[model samples]
Target: MAVDVLNESNWAVEPRVFSDLGLWVMDQMKISTDCDLTIIFNEPDAMEELHLRWMNLEGPTDVMSFPMDELRPGDGTTDVEGMLGDIVLCPAVAATQAQSAGHSTIEELMLLTIHGCLHLLGFDHSDKDQEKEMFGIQRQLLLTYLAARPGELNEVIPLEISGE
Candidate 1:
């Protein structure tokens, strides 16, 4: 997977970690190595504009996904490869949610990163059953990702989505 991270936020972000997280998600989804993914950390203003234009929402959201190829996870084939799309994240907004959720800003960003990638891969929580399946896979992937990096575990807790 070709993963690129563009940080345009005021806060300092570990771009490599975001790249690794994106790649790991692709691996877990069995996407081909030829696929491309980009993660963008933007200021709240930029995010708000995007939210208004694309989603027609009024404010900055935590994360937004723009999928290019409409790839779905675990189709069990890598015969096709293309741009997976961009995950635009607003750290400024995530910080507020992190405080409420009792986790570090980085942890919240990580969770949002995974959540955004899942969306790019055609995962959604449009209904109760979809929420269960998506959040279950999300939590499992996050836990495994955290467990694999014990040192980074200090930087992140086991994230618990409120409704999951």
Candidate 2:
């Protein structure tokens, strides 16, 4: 998968974190295609638009997904290879949420990326059962990612959204 990260937001984030997120998403999903994923950081106001359009809310959301195609079983056709989708993140919202959740902004961003990627992979948390399954897997993947790099460990923070 080709993961492209674009930082257009006013907030600051390390580039390597974005790359790590791409790898984590690919590994967790077991997606073995030349998928192209773009992580764009947009203005907080832009996210408000998404909140109104997608979630029917009046405020900004942490992340949004724009899948290019519906999730389908892979065919033998290698024409498209694999183009999963694009995940747009609002760093400002992430930062704010991170502060409220008492965690680093990077952790918040990573969680948002994982959440968006899960949506692209057809994981939704709108229902109770689905929320448990999806959030459980998200936390597992996040713990794995964090454990792999112990040097970067700052704290064992809890996730904002729980499996329950």
Candidate 3:
């Protein structure tokens, strides 16, 4: 899997963490090694513009996904491959949400990354059942990712991934 994280925001960003999360999400979903995904971090002003333009929402949201190729999760027998879409993130907004959610900004960002990946893989939460299924998968993905990492809880680092 090819994962790239571009920081287009004013905040200092760790490109590896986001890239690592993307690779993890791809592997967990049984996506092919040839798949590519991009995650971009943006400022709230830019994010607000995107939110209004793309989603038609009024304010900046924590995350938004634009899926291309419409890739879906695959069975282990045959992994799916495509140019998975982009995940746009707002760190300033994530910080505020993290404060309310009682976690660090990085944790919130990581969760949003997984959520965005799910969206890229065609997961939706429009209804109650859909919400349950999607969110359950999200929680499971987070936990499994956490469990696989080799670090202290406070200093969790994303896995390092290179080309297969």
| Winning model by lDDT | 3
lDDT of 2 by residue, 1-164 (tens): 37878877766556567766676667556664457778888888988997899878898888999887755333434333367788989877888888999987778888889888888878899999999998998888888888888865354342233233
Q: Write the per-residue lDDT of candidate 1 for residues 19-55, one digit (tens) a residue.
A: 8889888888887656889999888899999999999
User: Which ranges in model 2 have alpha carbons more than 4 Å from their true place?
Assistant: 72-81, 153-164
Candidate 3: count the clashes.
Answer: 0
TM-score of model 2 vs. true structure: 0.82
Model 3, 1-164: lDDT tens per residue?
39888888877667877788798889889997568899999988999999999989998999999999999999888889889989999988988888899987888888999999999999999999999999999989888887888552356442222231
Instruction: Give the count of colliding residue pairs in each prediction.
Output: 0, 0, 0
State in Å the error of residue 92, model 3.
Answer: 0.7
Model 3 residue pairs with clashes: none
Candidate 1 residue-wise lDDT at 113: 90
Compute the lDDT of residue 57 as modeled in candidate 1. 93
| Candidates' C-alpha lDDT | 0.85, 0.75, 0.85
Give the per-residue Cα lDDT of candidate 2 at 23. 60
Structural RMSD, model 2:
6.6
RMSD, model 1, all Cα superposed? 5.7
